[model samples]
Target: NAGVTQTPKFHILKIGQSMTLQCTQDMNHNYMYWYRQDPGMGLKLIYYSVGAGITDKGEVPNGYNVSRSTTEDFPLRLELAAPSQTSVYFCASSYSGGGYGYTFGSGTRLTVV
Candidate 1:
Protein backbone atom coordinates (compact mmCIF):
# COMPACT_ATOMS: atom_id res chain seq x y z
CA ASN A 1 0.00 0.00 0.00
CA ALA A 2 1.03 3.62 -0.51
CA GLY A 3 0.37 4.56 3.09
CA VAL A 4 -0.59 8.17 4.05
CA THR A 5 0.44 11.44 2.44
CA GLN A 6 -0.01 15.09 3.50
CA THR A 7 0.42 18.21 1.41
CA PRO A 8 2.01 21.63 2.00
CA LYS A 9 4.77 20.18 4.14
CA PHE A 10 5.27 23.65 5.57
CA HIS A 11 2.99 26.68 5.93
CA ILE A 12 2.81 30.10 7.52
CA LEU A 13 -0.62 31.64 8.09
CA LYS A 14 -1.74 34.95 9.49
CA ILE A 15 -3.74 35.17 12.70
CA GLY A 16 -7.10 35.11 10.97
CA GLN A 17 -6.33 33.13 7.88
CA SER A 18 -7.31 29.55 7.18
CA MET A 19 -6.00 26.49 5.41
CA THR A 20 -6.80 22.91 4.65
CA LEU A 21 -4.26 20.19 5.24
CA GLN A 22 -4.86 17.48 2.74
CA CYS A 23 -4.44 13.82 3.58
CA THR A 24 -4.91 10.58 1.72
CA GLN A 25 -4.08 6.89 2.03
CA ASP A 26 -4.01 3.93 -0.27
CA MET A 27 -4.12 1.24 2.39
CA ASN A 28 -7.92 1.18 2.53
CA HIS A 29 -7.83 1.94 6.24
CA ASN A 30 -11.04 2.14 8.22
CA TYR A 31 -9.77 4.67 10.72
CA MET A 32 -8.19 8.06 10.04
CA TYR A 33 -6.86 10.63 12.46
CA TRP A 34 -5.40 14.13 12.72
CA TYR A 35 -2.87 15.06 15.39
CA ARG A 36 -0.69 17.97 16.31
CA GLN A 37 2.80 17.60 17.70
CA ASP A 38 4.14 20.52 19.64
CA PRO A 39 7.82 21.13 20.09
CA GLY A 40 9.28 18.73 22.66
CA MET A 41 5.79 17.50 23.45
CA GLY A 42 3.66 14.48 22.68
CA LEU A 43 1.05 14.17 19.96
CA LYS A 44 -2.43 15.54 20.67
CA LEU A 45 -5.36 14.26 18.73
CA ILE A 46 -7.31 16.91 16.80
CA TYR A 47 -9.94 14.82 15.07
CA TYR A 48 -10.70 11.26 14.08
CA SER A 49 -13.10 9.19 12.04
CA VAL A 50 -13.84 5.51 12.48
CA GLY A 51 -15.12 5.26 8.93
CA ALA A 52 -16.88 7.30 6.28
CA GLY A 53 -19.59 9.56 7.72
CA ILE A 54 -18.35 8.90 11.25
CA THR A 55 -16.15 11.81 12.21
CA ASP A 56 -15.65 13.09 15.74
CA LYS A 57 -13.77 15.72 17.65
CA GLY A 58 -10.63 14.77 19.53
CA GLU A 59 -8.55 16.14 22.41
CA VAL A 60 -7.57 19.42 20.73
CA PRO A 61 -10.31 20.14 18.28
CA ASN A 62 -10.53 23.88 18.79
CA GLY A 63 -9.72 25.99 15.73
CA TYR A 64 -9.83 22.84 13.65
CA ASN A 65 -12.30 20.63 11.81
CA VAL A 66 -12.21 17.48 9.74
CA SER A 67 -14.26 15.31 7.44
CA ARG A 68 -13.90 11.74 6.22
CA SER A 69 -16.01 11.38 3.12
CA THR A 70 -14.27 8.28 1.86
CA THR A 71 -11.89 5.57 3.02
CA GLU A 72 -8.90 7.32 1.48
CA ASP A 73 -9.25 10.98 2.38
CA PHE A 74 -9.47 12.87 5.65
CA PRO A 75 -8.57 16.54 5.40
CA LEU A 76 -8.14 18.92 8.34
CA ARG A 77 -9.47 22.47 8.11
CA LEU A 78 -8.12 25.26 10.22
CA GLU A 79 -10.52 28.18 10.53
CA LEU A 80 -9.64 31.58 11.96
CA ALA A 81 -6.23 30.28 12.80
CA ALA A 82 -4.41 31.58 15.82
CA PRO A 83 -0.82 31.60 16.99
CA SER A 84 -1.62 28.69 19.28
CA GLN A 85 -2.51 26.66 16.22
CA THR A 86 1.04 26.79 14.99
CA SER A 87 2.41 23.27 15.20
CA VAL A 88 3.28 20.22 13.21
CA TYR A 89 0.19 18.42 11.95
CA PHE A 90 0.13 14.77 11.09
CA CYS A 91 -2.38 12.54 9.36
CA ALA A 92 -2.58 8.86 10.12
CA SER A 93 -4.51 5.83 8.99
CA SER A 94 -5.00 2.35 10.38
CA TYR A 95 -6.94 -0.80 9.65
CA SER A 96 -8.92 -0.73 12.93
CA GLY A 97 -6.71 -2.37 15.57
CA GLY A 98 -3.90 -1.62 17.96
CA GLY A 99 -1.68 -4.08 16.14
CA TYR A 100 -1.64 -1.92 13.00
CA GLY A 101 -0.17 1.00 14.97
CA TYR A 102 -1.36 3.49 12.33
CA THR A 103 0.55 4.80 9.33
CA PHE A 104 1.63 8.41 9.67
CA GLY A 105 2.02 11.02 6.97
CA SER A 106 5.20 13.01 6.47
CA GLY A 107 3.52 15.88 8.33
CA THR A 108 2.49 19.47 7.65
CA ARG A 109 4.38 22.12 9.55
CA LEU A 110 2.15 25.15 10.11
CA THR A 111 2.96 28.49 11.71
CA VAL A 112 0.06 30.78 12.51
CA VAL A 113 1.52 34.24 12.74
Candidate 2:
Protein backbone atom coordinates (compact mmCIF):
# COMPACT_ATOMS: atom_id res chain seq x y z
CA ASN A 1 0.00 0.00 0.00
CA ALA A 2 0.98 3.65 -0.39
CA GLY A 3 0.13 4.51 3.16
CA VAL A 4 3.59 4.38 4.72
CA THR A 5 6.94 3.29 3.35
CA GLN A 6 10.14 2.53 5.22
CA THR A 7 13.44 2.21 3.43
CA PRO A 8 16.32 -0.23 3.92
CA LYS A 9 14.19 -3.07 5.21
CA PHE A 10 17.30 -4.73 6.70
CA HIS A 11 20.65 -3.42 7.85
CA ILE A 12 23.73 -4.40 9.81
CA LEU A 13 25.73 -1.77 11.58
CA LYS A 14 29.10 -1.77 13.31
CA ILE A 15 29.66 -0.15 16.68
CA GLY A 16 29.91 3.64 16.43
CA GLN A 17 28.33 3.70 13.00
CA SER A 18 25.28 5.73 12.23
CA MET A 19 22.30 5.48 9.93
CA THR A 20 18.97 7.09 9.21
CA LEU A 21 15.81 5.09 8.93
CA GLN A 22 13.68 6.78 6.35
CA CYS A 23 9.90 6.94 6.78
CA THR A 24 7.36 8.60 4.59
CA GLN A 25 3.63 8.64 4.40
CA ASP A 26 1.36 9.66 1.58
CA MET A 27 -1.68 10.08 3.78
CA ASN A 28 -0.50 13.44 5.10
CA HIS A 29 -1.05 12.44 8.67
CA ASN A 30 -0.26 15.07 11.24
CA TYR A 31 0.99 12.71 13.95
CA MET A 32 4.06 10.61 13.29
CA TYR A 33 5.96 8.30 15.57
CA TRP A 34 9.09 6.22 15.69
CA TYR A 35 8.96 2.98 17.57
CA ARG A 36 11.25 0.06 18.17
CA GLN A 37 10.31 -3.50 19.05
CA ASP A 38 12.81 -5.84 20.59
CA PRO A 39 12.51 -9.58 20.60
CA GLY A 40 9.96 -10.84 23.14
CA MET A 41 9.19 -7.28 24.12
CA GLY A 42 6.49 -4.76 23.35
CA LEU A 43 7.04 -1.76 21.14
CA LYS A 44 8.80 1.19 22.72
CA LEU A 45 8.13 4.69 21.52
CA ILE A 46 11.28 6.56 20.59
CA TYR A 47 10.06 9.84 19.23
CA TYR A 48 7.02 11.59 17.81
CA SER A 49 5.98 14.77 16.11
CA VAL A 50 2.67 16.46 15.88
CA GLY A 51 3.42 18.49 12.82
CA ALA A 52 6.21 19.85 10.70
CA GLY A 53 9.14 21.25 12.69
CA ILE A 54 7.62 20.09 15.93
CA THR A 55 8.88 17.04 17.76
CA ASP A 56 9.04 15.51 21.21
CA LYS A 57 10.73 12.58 22.90
CA GLY A 58 8.83 9.45 23.76
CA GLU A 59 9.57 6.65 26.23
CA VAL A 60 12.86 5.48 24.69
CA PRO A 61 14.81 8.28 23.02
CA ASN A 62 18.26 7.59 24.37
CA GLY A 63 20.05 6.41 21.24
CA TYR A 64 17.78 7.82 18.60
CA ASN A 65 16.76 11.10 17.06
CA VAL A 66 13.88 12.17 14.85
CA SER A 67 12.91 15.15 12.76
CA ARG A 68 9.68 16.05 11.06
CA SER A 69 10.54 18.51 8.37
CA THR A 70 7.32 18.06 6.48
CA THR A 71 3.99 16.36 6.78
CA GLU A 72 5.12 13.39 4.73
CA ASP A 73 8.60 12.66 6.03
CA PHE A 74 9.82 11.69 9.45
CA PRO A 75 13.28 10.22 9.61
CA LEU A 76 14.76 8.45 12.61
CA ARG A 77 18.50 8.78 13.08
CA LEU A 78 20.82 6.56 15.03
CA GLU A 79 23.83 8.64 16.02
CA LEU A 80 26.06 5.85 17.29
CA ALA A 81 24.93 2.35 16.67
CA ALA A 82 24.98 0.00 19.64
CA PRO A 83 24.20 -3.64 20.09
CA SER A 84 21.43 -2.68 22.44
CA GLN A 85 19.83 -0.71 19.64
CA THR A 86 19.26 -3.76 17.53
CA SER A 87 15.56 -4.14 16.95
CA VAL A 88 12.78 -3.83 14.43
CA TYR A 89 11.94 -0.20 13.95
CA PHE A 90 8.49 0.88 12.89
CA CYS A 91 7.03 4.19 11.75
CA ALA A 92 3.42 5.05 12.18
CA SER A 93 1.19 7.97 11.37
CA SER A 94 -2.25 9.08 12.30
CA TYR A 95 -4.59 11.89 11.41
CA SER A 96 -4.64 12.85 15.04
CA GLY A 97 -3.27 11.61 18.33
CA GLY A 98 -6.65 10.77 19.77
CA GLY A 99 -8.62 7.63 19.04
CA TYR A 100 -7.88 7.67 15.34
CA GLY A 101 -6.26 4.61 13.84
CA TYR A 102 -2.66 4.72 12.64
CA THR A 103 -1.01 3.47 9.51
CA PHE A 104 2.27 1.72 10.12
CA GLY A 105 5.17 1.07 7.82
CA SER A 106 6.45 -2.41 7.23
CA GLY A 107 9.55 -1.99 9.43
CA THR A 108 13.28 -1.63 9.38
CA ARG A 109 15.24 -4.50 10.89
CA LEU A 110 18.53 -3.25 12.26
CA THR A 111 21.37 -5.19 13.81
CA VAL A 112 24.22 -3.39 15.49
CA VAL A 113 27.33 -5.47 15.92
Candidate 3:
Protein backbone atom coordinates (compact mmCIF):
# COMPACT_ATOMS: atom_id res chain seq x y z
CA ASN A 1 0.00 0.00 0.00
CA ALA A 2 1.11 3.57 -0.57
CA GLY A 3 1.75 4.96 2.87
CA VAL A 4 1.91 8.52 1.56
CA THR A 5 2.17 10.12 -1.86
CA GLN A 6 2.96 13.68 -3.01
CA THR A 7 2.54 15.04 -6.50
CA PRO A 8 4.78 17.23 -8.66
CA LYS A 9 7.98 16.10 -6.97
CA PHE A 10 9.75 19.20 -8.25
CA HIS A 11 8.44 22.56 -9.35
CA ILE A 12 9.50 26.12 -10.07
CA LEU A 13 7.18 29.01 -9.40
CA LYS A 14 7.20 32.57 -10.67
CA ILE A 15 7.33 35.47 -8.21
CA GLY A 16 3.57 35.36 -7.85
CA GLN A 17 2.37 32.12 -9.34
CA SER A 18 0.61 29.57 -7.15
CA MET A 19 0.20 25.84 -6.93
CA THR A 20 -1.25 23.07 -4.82
CA LEU A 21 0.93 20.38 -3.35
CA GLN A 22 -1.07 17.18 -3.31
CA CYS A 23 -0.80 14.56 -0.60
CA THR A 24 -2.56 11.26 -0.17
CA GLN A 25 -2.30 8.32 2.18
CA ASP A 26 -3.65 4.81 2.02
CA MET A 27 -3.06 3.89 5.67
CA ASN A 28 -6.23 5.54 6.95
CA HIS A 29 -4.37 7.55 9.52
CA ASN A 30 -6.18 10.12 11.61
CA TYR A 31 -3.36 12.63 12.15
CA MET A 32 -1.97 14.34 9.11
CA TYR A 33 0.51 17.21 8.86
CA TRP A 34 2.22 19.45 6.36
CA TYR A 35 5.81 20.45 7.01
CA ARG A 36 8.45 22.46 5.20
CA GLN A 37 12.16 21.76 5.36
CA ASP A 38 14.95 24.21 4.69
CA PRO A 39 18.67 23.70 4.33
CA GLY A 40 20.42 22.89 7.62
CA MET A 41 17.17 23.30 9.51
CA GLY A 42 14.55 20.92 10.83
CA LEU A 43 11.08 20.58 9.47
CA LYS A 44 8.59 23.28 10.40
CA LEU A 45 4.90 22.47 10.68
CA ILE A 46 2.81 24.54 8.30
CA TYR A 47 -0.59 23.02 8.99
CA TYR A 48 -2.29 19.90 10.32
CA SER A 49 -5.57 18.06 10.55
CA VAL A 50 -6.76 15.62 13.13
CA GLY A 51 -9.36 14.18 10.81
CA ALA A 52 -11.66 15.00 7.97
CA GLY A 53 -13.29 18.45 8.19
CA ILE A 54 -10.95 19.46 11.02
CA THR A 55 -7.97 21.54 10.05
CA ASP A 56 -5.62 23.85 11.93
CA LYS A 57 -2.73 26.16 11.22
CA GLY A 58 0.71 25.34 12.50
CA GLU A 59 3.88 27.27 13.31
CA VAL A 60 4.58 28.49 9.78
CA PRO A 61 1.17 28.80 8.18
CA ASN A 62 1.40 32.36 6.93
CA GLY A 63 2.44 31.63 3.35
CA TYR A 64 0.36 28.50 2.97
CA ASN A 65 -3.01 26.89 3.56
CA VAL A 66 -4.34 23.38 3.96
CA SER A 67 -7.50 21.32 3.98
CA ARG A 68 -8.38 17.81 5.04
CA SER A 69 -11.46 16.81 3.10
CA THR A 70 -11.01 13.11 3.97
CA THR A 71 -9.00 10.82 6.18
CA GLU A 72 -6.75 9.73 3.35
CA ASP A 73 -5.99 13.12 1.87
CA PHE A 74 -4.49 16.42 2.98
CA PRO A 75 -3.61 18.99 0.36
CA LEU A 76 -1.57 22.18 0.81
CA ARG A 77 -2.32 25.35 -1.12
CA LEU A 78 0.05 28.21 -1.71
CA GLU A 79 -1.59 31.44 -2.77
CA LEU A 80 0.47 34.27 -4.28
CA ALA A 81 3.55 32.22 -3.61
CA ALA A 82 6.61 34.08 -2.43
CA PRO A 83 10.35 33.47 -2.51
CA SER A 84 10.47 32.88 1.21
CA GLN A 85 8.12 29.94 0.67
CA THR A 86 10.68 28.04 -1.31
CA SER A 87 11.47 24.79 0.44
CA VAL A 88 10.85 21.08 0.44
CA TYR A 89 7.27 20.29 1.32
CA PHE A 90 6.55 17.04 3.07
CA CYS A 91 3.27 15.32 3.83
CA ALA A 92 3.11 13.07 6.84
CA SER A 93 0.69 10.99 8.88
CA SER A 94 0.66 9.01 12.09
CA TYR A 95 -1.79 6.93 14.06
CA SER A 96 -0.45 8.50 17.22
CA GLY A 97 2.33 10.83 18.31
CA GLY A 98 6.12 10.57 18.24
CA GLY A 99 6.12 7.16 19.88
CA TYR A 100 4.80 5.71 16.66
CA GLY A 101 6.90 7.94 14.42
CA TYR A 102 5.45 9.12 11.11
CA THR A 103 5.01 8.05 7.51
CA PHE A 104 6.17 10.80 5.17
CA GLY A 105 6.19 11.24 1.44
CA SER A 106 9.37 11.78 -0.58
CA GLY A 107 8.69 15.51 -0.50
CA THR A 108 8.03 18.17 -3.10
CA ARG A 109 10.95 20.47 -3.80
CA LEU A 110 9.73 23.95 -4.63
CA THR A 111 11.68 26.90 -5.94
CA VAL A 112 10.45 30.46 -6.38
CA VAL A 113 12.22 33.19 -8.27
Candidate 4:
Protein backbone atom coordinates (compact mmCIF):
# COMPACT_ATOMS: atom_id res chain seq x y z
CA ASN A 1 0.00 0.00 0.00
CA ALA A 2 3.00 2.24 0.38
CA GLY A 3 4.80 1.52 -2.86
CA VAL A 4 4.69 2.31 -6.55
CA THR A 5 1.60 1.31 -8.57
CA GLN A 6 1.03 1.41 -12.31
CA THR A 7 -2.21 0.99 -14.19
CA PRO A 8 -3.11 -0.85 -17.39
CA LYS A 9 -0.66 -3.71 -17.11
CA PHE A 10 -0.89 -4.24 -20.89
CA HIS A 11 -1.93 -2.07 -23.82
CA ILE A 12 -1.95 -1.82 -27.59
CA LEU A 13 -1.96 1.46 -29.46
CA LYS A 14 -2.73 2.18 -33.07
CA ILE A 15 -0.52 4.43 -35.13
CA GLY A 16 -0.82 8.07 -34.09
CA GLN A 17 -2.90 7.20 -31.03
CA SER A 18 -2.10 8.51 -27.58
CA MET A 19 -2.34 7.36 -24.00
CA THR A 20 -1.19 8.14 -20.53
CA LEU A 21 0.52 5.54 -18.40
CA GLN A 22 -0.54 6.19 -14.86
CA CYS A 23 1.94 5.86 -12.01
CA THR A 24 1.52 6.68 -8.38
CA GLN A 25 3.23 6.03 -5.08
CA ASP A 26 2.28 6.37 -1.47
CA MET A 27 5.77 6.35 -0.04
CA ASN A 28 6.13 10.15 -0.35
CA HIS A 29 9.33 9.78 -2.30
CA ASN A 30 10.99 12.83 -3.78
CA TYR A 31 12.75 11.17 -6.66
CA MET A 32 10.76 9.46 -9.42
CA TYR A 33 11.65 8.15 -12.85
CA TRP A 34 10.11 6.67 -15.97
CA TYR A 35 12.05 4.07 -17.90
CA ARG A 36 11.41 2.03 -21.00
CA GLN A 37 12.91 -1.39 -21.58
CA ASP A 38 13.01 -2.79 -25.06
CA PRO A 39 13.32 -6.48 -25.70
CA GLY A 40 16.82 -7.81 -25.03
CA MET A 41 18.03 -4.42 -23.84
CA GLY A 42 18.50 -2.61 -20.59
CA LEU A 43 16.20 0.03 -19.21
CA LYS A 44 16.51 3.51 -20.73
CA LEU A 45 15.48 6.47 -18.70
CA ILE A 46 12.81 8.64 -20.27
CA TYR A 47 12.20 11.30 -17.70
CA TYR A 48 12.73 12.04 -14.04
CA SER A 49 11.65 14.48 -11.37
CA VAL A 50 13.54 15.34 -8.26
CA GLY A 51 10.54 16.87 -6.53
CA ALA A 52 7.12 18.29 -7.10
CA GLY A 53 6.86 20.98 -9.79
CA ILE A 54 10.28 20.05 -11.14
CA THR A 55 11.05 17.65 -13.98
CA ASP A 56 13.89 16.83 -16.36
CA LYS A 57 14.55 14.69 -19.39
CA GLY A 58 16.55 11.49 -19.21
CA GLU A 59 18.28 9.40 -21.85
CA VAL A 60 15.25 8.89 -24.09
CA PRO A 61 12.51 11.50 -23.92
CA ASN A 62 11.74 12.41 -27.50
CA GLY A 63 8.38 10.61 -27.57
CA TYR A 64 7.38 10.90 -23.95
CA ASN A 65 6.36 13.46 -21.38
CA VAL A 66 6.05 13.50 -17.60
CA SER A 67 4.79 15.82 -14.90
CA ARG A 68 5.26 15.84 -11.16
CA SER A 69 2.33 17.84 -9.81
CA THR A 70 2.56 16.21 -6.41
CA THR A 71 4.85 13.99 -4.43
CA GLU A 72 2.84 10.82 -5.10
CA ASP A 73 2.06 11.00 -8.80
CA PHE A 74 4.18 10.85 -11.94
CA PRO A 75 2.30 10.05 -15.13
CA LEU A 76 3.91 9.28 -18.47
CA ARG A 77 2.21 10.61 -21.59
CA LEU A 78 2.70 9.24 -25.05
CA GLU A 79 1.55 11.62 -27.73
CA LEU A 80 1.09 10.43 -31.30
CA ALA A 81 2.23 6.94 -30.51
CA ALA A 82 4.66 5.28 -32.87
CA PRO A 83 5.86 1.74 -33.34
CA SER A 84 9.25 2.79 -32.04
CA GLN A 85 7.61 3.53 -28.73
CA THR A 86 6.67 -0.08 -28.15
CA SER A 87 8.32 -1.24 -24.98
CA VAL A 88 7.76 -2.07 -21.33
CA TYR A 89 7.45 1.08 -19.26
CA PHE A 90 8.44 1.05 -15.64
CA CYS A 91 7.80 3.64 -12.96
CA ALA A 92 10.05 3.86 -9.95
CA SER A 93 10.65 6.06 -6.96
CA SER A 94 13.27 6.57 -4.29
CA TYR A 95 13.77 8.66 -1.21
CA SER A 96 16.96 10.04 -2.75
CA GLY A 97 19.08 9.44 -5.81
CA GLY A 98 21.74 6.70 -5.46
CA GLY A 99 22.47 4.42 -2.50
CA TYR A 100 18.77 3.90 -1.69
CA GLY A 101 17.13 1.26 -3.79
CA TYR A 102 14.13 2.07 -5.94
CA THR A 103 10.63 0.62 -5.69
CA PHE A 104 9.31 -0.21 -9.15
CA GLY A 105 5.78 -0.83 -10.28
CA SER A 106 4.73 -3.98 -12.10
CA GLY A 107 5.19 -2.13 -15.42
CA THR A 108 3.07 -1.31 -18.46
CA ARG A 109 3.65 -3.27 -21.62
CA LEU A 110 2.79 -1.09 -24.62
CA THR A 111 2.67 -2.13 -28.24
CA VAL A 112 2.15 0.16 -31.16
CA VAL A 113 0.90 -1.14 -34.44
lDDT of 1 by residue, 1-113 (tens): 66899998999999999889999999989999999999788999999999998998889898888888898999999999999998999999989945779889999999988
Candidate 1 vs 2: which has more TM-score: 2
TM-score for each candidate, following the candidate numbering? 0.95, 0.97, 0.96, 0.97
- Is candidate 1 or 3 superior in TM-score? 3
Error of 2 at 28 (Å): 1.0
**lDDT per model, in order?**
0.92, 0.94, 0.92, 0.95
Candidate 2: deviation at residue 19, Å?
Answer: 0.5
Tens digit of lDDT per residue, candidate 2, span 1-113? 49999998999999999999999999979999999998788999999999999999999999888888899999999998999999999999999985899889999999999
TM-score of 4: 0.97
Compose the digit string of candidate 4's lDDT tens values, residues 1-113. 75999999999999999999999999999999999999788999999999999999999999888889999999999999999999999999999976799999999999999
Q: Which residue pairs of candidate 4 clash?
A: none
Worst lDDT window (10 residues) for model 3?
Answer: 93-102
The local distance difference test score of model 3 is: 0.92
Give me the displacement of residue 30 in model 2, in angstroms.
0.4
Clashing pairs in 3: none
Minimal lDDT window, size 10, model 1 = 94-103
Candidate 4 residue 17 Cα shift, in angstroms, is 0.7
Q: How close is candidate 3 to the true structure, as a TM-score?
A: 0.96
TM-score of candidate 1 against the unseen true structure: 0.95
